[model samples]
Target: MSDNQQPAKNHVTLLLLSVMLLGAALVFAVAADAPHTLVLTAAGLGLSFSRRTPLSRTTRSYVYAGVSVLAATVLQDQIFPVDTQRFYLIDGRYYAPAVIFLGIAITFFEQRDTTLTSVISLALIGTMIAGNSGATIVTNPRFPMTNGLLDYFHFFYGCVVAVQMLAMLAVLPHVDRRVRLPAPGRAWRWHRATVFWVSVFGVAGTVVGLRVAAIHYERLADRTFRDLFRVYMRRQSERMIFGYEVDLWRTVPPRTRADKTPVVRALAAQAPGYLRGRAFVRYGRGTWSSSDTGEHLPPTRPGGRYAYSVFRRALAGRTPSATPPPAPRPATIDLLPATAYPLGGLLAPGNAVEFELIADGLNNSNEGALVPREWDVAGGYSLALDDSIRDTAYQGPAEPPTEAERYLDIPGHIKEDVARVANTVFGATPPRPGTQGRLAQLSRFFEAGFTYELGVKFDPAGKDPILQFVEQRRGHCELFAATTVLLLRAQGIPARYVTGFVCGERPPSGTYWVARLEDAHAWTEAYVAEENRWVLVENTPASGFPTTDSASGVVSRAFDRLLVAWQNLLAQVKRGYVAEVIVALFLGLCRGLGRLLTHPLWGPVAVLSLGSAVWWLWQRRRRRRLAAADRLLVPTRTELQKTLGVLEKQARRFGVERQPCNTIRELARRLESAAQGPLRDALLELLREYETLRYQGTPPAVEAVAEFKAKVRRRLAAPG
Candidate 1:
């Protein structure tokens, strides 16, 4: 309504907007792993323009004291019990303390005094050191802590305090006198105080900027900021790129080739068969990707006899009989740490009748690949597939399903080459028109000519990798699988490229199959129009894939089992099951303690002993801080010296100087002689207050001290 009120309203609006921006940046930093620069810039700009009012010094001090009490209570296990098994929540415990200290520092900005500012600065610096130490102890187990670059815990708490301090300095009208015209003679004093604080903030900003730049440079040299943030946040799974991309591409050497990295272990009567991860329908010049944009199938319950019968008939290349058979046998699988992506579920060659997964988020893709919604450290699922009809011929309808079209996708660049190769291998017109005949002919072509070699490299920039494989007669499983899928598509058969792990080395006990990273294999699956099913067609030579005997060693197998157990433990921890167990154990212990304390005769003695011990501990800790108490008292003595100097300067203005050995009361009497009326009364009052505070153990209140100092200034300014 009024012109004077307009600027204040604008400042308030700017402050709200800045706070919102900073809050958004904080959320983004947490969720999206945003760059530190983005968060820092947002926070800095927000503080620069904000004009929110700060809490009064006394109110803020009370809040800080309350928070400190709460922290002490929680640390003592009186409020929140500390469970070592559930220690992951320890970082969250730092929040209340950080907020309290930051609130106190911001309140100090309202008072334009360098002494208070320095004290707040020192408090914040001390808090940073303690917070970082606690964080390091909780997050890492190793001792002799090394100061690493981009310490998220330190940076986060430090930023919170710094932002609040800057916001208070920027917004509080009392902090910067230039924002308003002051009274005559008082203008220079206010200007000097303003410059001093601004310079302090400027120096702080320069130091922080240099530290951030150093961190950024260090992170850039080793890895990206996103990766560093992931490590900091302990979200390692987010960095994993699941799907066919990593499996299909051979940019790096296979893990198995370098060293045996166990992926899965199966406990079954026979070999668990290939474990399919994902399927791709489209084939480009040198790449393969899924083109079937089909929605995931709804989760199904465990099927009984009827489902099994139907599945058996479908896989057998025959129409289902009206009568149903018995339920199929189940096979169990244990996914390992080396298996980076989710294994959807353990699948066999034929249709799965039932799946009992010991995990959640399982879904079946349109291309028949099983994918889980999230990554799991270790999980298991049992499924029963219709193995009886797996190798049978098709006997379904003539027309193919609409979904089959995507599986026939072939890039235009290699379409001609694919057709020519298919024509030469199986003849332009095959001996049989069915899917089985074409598959048999393709298998013979690979077996007779192509050689299996992991070392074979293909130049993607040149001709298509599949074409190179066909011409050179040498390549790995990926090239073989890609060529097979392309060849099937060329022959008017719908086929998709599949990436998974083949059944690897089986131990002497023969209880299970161990699938390692080296067991990662690729193949093709072609859809049969008659059977209304997709059949796996392996074209890669058997010699190229890992065999059951490749992995063997008593010590190695024992270590693998240990690793599997460790992985399972981690998975349980992630799922909160371990925390639940720990809490249950803790409650049981507390109940037992209550029973023990209720014993008739010893109960009173036990209680007394416990109380005495606690009291003794408290006293010991209090006495331990005696040296620190002496150090803290040094600042109060310095402040007294500063106050005496100010009083002497004011007396000089009145042209009155008592002897050096004169007491404060004698000086005050001399100053009173130089003055009269209210000025004389003020000098006597100020001297009496100072004498009581200095001589006695009791110090005057902050407000009382401020009032006495103001009286001295007013008296010096008045005309005698």
Candidate 2:
């Protein structure tokens, strides 16, 4: 390998290979109906990693996976429709997101921008997007159009993955060479090992890493995620908020993100007050969890506006009193929930028993919390209640007085911050009387200095998100609610965490109030012994609530309604195969096997046939291995030409297709991807020699050519 012995092909060929792989992947993703999210994930990660930050292929792959999940999964509302409006912002100016997105992608398409870092960013990021997006487009309600379509889809995805792996493998060596000096001085054995290991895990790792990447792309490309980059402006106003659950503690690799997909619709003339969802009795660390000790009411269809079920006084923790009847307004709306089980239940501004409520089924906790049964929770449900009031008490189980202590308890680690905030807000004032007075007192915390913001991230560098939020005086509803709960608990007011939607908007044509994911919120519910029941307390600043313009845009609302309608259509189309043909075939095969075994007459023949098939496979594999070994030992007619053919066949077998335009150098690189160890390095050296001689316009002497071919044969025969 002389310095002047240049390879015939250049980076252009590699560029074409990389682009082909990317295009193939995107084609499959888009055809699978997952292009929007997959493209967003790739563009977002690629744009970020393409900046001058130094990172490795392996490191980039892992980072892409982790950050994509965090940004796209836990906070889907904030991340999706990355561009909702016709225009997106750039340096405070508006531009079409599609133009900007496509522009950048094309810029990187050419290998002119290719570097060790940039190329890996493209390859690895593309892979994560393709695998994750494709996974989402083909699951659950997405039954195959015909029998075995899912299996065929999976096979297609596998082929696309194979293409990506082959391209990356081919480009990896050049990427390695561009970043390192050819020779290194021999040092201590340990030091040599360090250098060897530090060559970015050397060539062998590409194979291992190829399999390791795309491990969790499915999460980022969540089925519910909407990459509304086209809706950039609409996306701009969308913010991350709490989902259906009352989750307090921060999560790691969250189980799910906030979904904007329409889950349920409440059709009513007026909006439901705080559609009370989940109520948590216990709080620890930074999380809130539920202790659901209640009863499951079977589906009840009572006569004359039949109430689906009733919330007994025992569950409300209320002694019989002059509880006002729910305002008579029965409305119907089908729920299109996000999960298998809709976590939170509706509160239609009615007394515990006033409004009739039932899904396919309902679960009532002793504390008045409700959830739909495991699966059948969609379609229409009926409820009657007044929509005038926004403030409502969330109740819990009635039991031993000691049980109330749990609400007053605060995580010991944050007791200091809690005390500080309580003092700042309450300021030694005498405890307020009744639930209203307590709520008035709690509202002071929001007034004191805090500000409501949606684009907030947890700050782990200083104190926990609790104190940091107080010190900084800025965050979303979750922060406002969590801090308010902590403030009240510090003063001995029994408070529990609550989460649900604040429904307000009605669709253009429909009477029902539509509660989009952005409206998801958190508020504190405190128990006042004097009131004999829990009462709602909204401590979030007024700014936290959606504005008329923000929440009730006619176009945005229309688009949302249409999107929901479309989603509902897809979910209910149900035109695919009614039964799993694969399962039926399996069962039939099982029955045949059983009959054959039981008959005893045919059992021996079956076993013999199985044995013969296995033996045939083994023999075929052995023969291939033997033929491979023999070829490596003997050189064919032409010097170097025979070796190239063998290498080409090996490369093709590994899914590395060669173009007719490929030069010998391009062929060698592709072959190197399928070959490894001494065989790979030997190919590189032999190619260099042939190029050097060809450049000089002189053929190598017969003896030298013979010796060169023999040397290559020896290297091929050598074990890795």
Candidate 3:
């Protein structure tokens, strides 16, 4: 590696290492959604290909041309790490092409620190690769992420960069000492010519990329790629410039993001019951108001002691059973953000008997309302619920309210319509005594034809909104609860509406249920005359009531994982982790891109196409300019003019040139004076042929001009 004599081998190794390093950063950048990968890629490619001479320069340039493209894929995990559009501003369509041109502009300097250039390029490339997928990517329950350290793609790249740095400690040994036509001057000219030709092909590549990208994204946007060519540029700008193509994502329908935003994080010994927020006693005009519940307010000084009273009243006059009751499930909940609702919620598990909030900072309203003092607080409210405490066969309240007009009344106007719904939902199935019977009935009604949609709107002046709900069978949680209350009340059953969150989402890796805005729900709670209890009734379709079922083994495993996650969080919080995390992310990006460029099919075709285009264009530019001497006026008017200009420019180089005379006779006199013998006779013959073709439009063989240029070059070089 320290041997300067091995330039060819060294260049090959550097190319491989450079591509690998760049590929890793690019992949990680895309995964992390860092947008600046575009700028770094263009600059890196431009700086790397600054070789001189037509053939070697173009070949070297092509080595870097298609390096920006590798593999085309849409990442499967629906995570987008880009928080802002700052990356897009820098990697704009205009900025990308400009960067390429500017990179070529950098090649205007020949004796550059290739080592420093590679280092800076890789460093910025590393930066654009940016942040880690977060620690979660490594330990996520999904195993695909950390497989084979594919996420560590640039380890090989880093090793090479380090080795090259060691060599840079030896840079002074490599400078050439030639005096006349010094190596630096020759290098300057060579570098200029190299970039000029690279620019030509770059422009062509840009035009072709743009045209193809437009056609593909516009006309073929909806269709399949059909071939590899179509997808080679997936997530990249048309080959014109290498930037992330935001619109090239596969057309998979996105998962609904409406409710993924979490509003609460609650931990439980098991999935806790529906956390109750508010309870409403009166129902009319399609609304449930939490007023006049006919119950005394519970005391609050002793934190959770007052809550047990609310539960005891519900369990009033209950009888104990022969079976042993299950232990109380304990849980804590925190409000993640301030919400429209007045309070967070009270934990209410199935058949909760003696409810107690171990933590305070919250208040309870007797009608099942638990209001939090602050939206986001360090301390969360904890409570216990006895899921196994059945209604225990209650036989109605000891002394029912004696008033003829109960304030907790359902409106009489909607009784007939609700009864009709009852007939349809129950279908002659005789009602059983306890709270479970009514709960089962309402559950069936919701499941029959109604859907759990959040978009169903209602008009206040319409013909009985509850009636309309039954007829149309479309409403949200509110309507579902109201309809259930009305239906239960129509059958002479006492029921009220309850609003709260249905916190039942238990992840495999978590001991908690996350509640989001979409989880805010409303349901019915009916007082069982025979059971003497207010039991929860889930009336919304698919909103099944909570159940307490968790094996000890599963709970233990989840607790262990939670502990590990907490420790990981602590590790990440330390200051030293910032650098390590940044490096890890860069490696991951490079690894991903490395996979793409190393693809068996896409990689080779890209390299070949780029090489061929550059090679052909360099040759063509050389032919047209006759650059061995210099380029003269470009003949666009006619064939005679084109041939004459070529001949005149070449003849002038040997100091025997003559041109621009209007008459053929006068031109002949001048050429005869400027030269003599074979050169003069040959020039006159060519002039006569040009005159013939200019006026007569008599087409001459295409070879006449080529044969003329060959003769002129050969004679001009004959020891003049």
Best by lDDT: 1
Q: Roughly what TM-score does model 3 have, to 2 decimal places?
A: 0.35
lDDT of 1 at 447: 91
Q: lDDT per residue, candidate 2, 595-621, as tens digits? A: 887677788888888899999999998
Off by over 4 Å in 1: 1-242, 246-257, 291-293, 296-329, 339-363, 379-399, 430-433, 459-461, 509-511, 568-720
At residue 134, candidate 2 shows an lDDT of 30
lDDT of 1 by residue, 251-354 (tens): 43534444465566766666666767667766665767664433343444333111101111122234454345344434434334455533434444435544
TM-score of each: 0.46, 0.40, 0.35
Task: Write candidate 3's Cα lDDT for 354-376 as tens digits.
Answer: 33232324443445454433222
Model 2, stretches more than 4 Å misplaced? Answer: 1-263, 301-361, 384-391, 400-403, 429-435, 547-720
- Give the better candidate number (1 or 3) by TM-score: 1
Best candidate according to TM-score:
1
* Evaluation by TM-score, superior candidate among 2 and 3: 2
What's model 1's lDDT at 717?
A: 63
Q: What is the lDDT of residue 499 in candidate 1?
A: 78
Local lDDT at 252 for model 2: 23
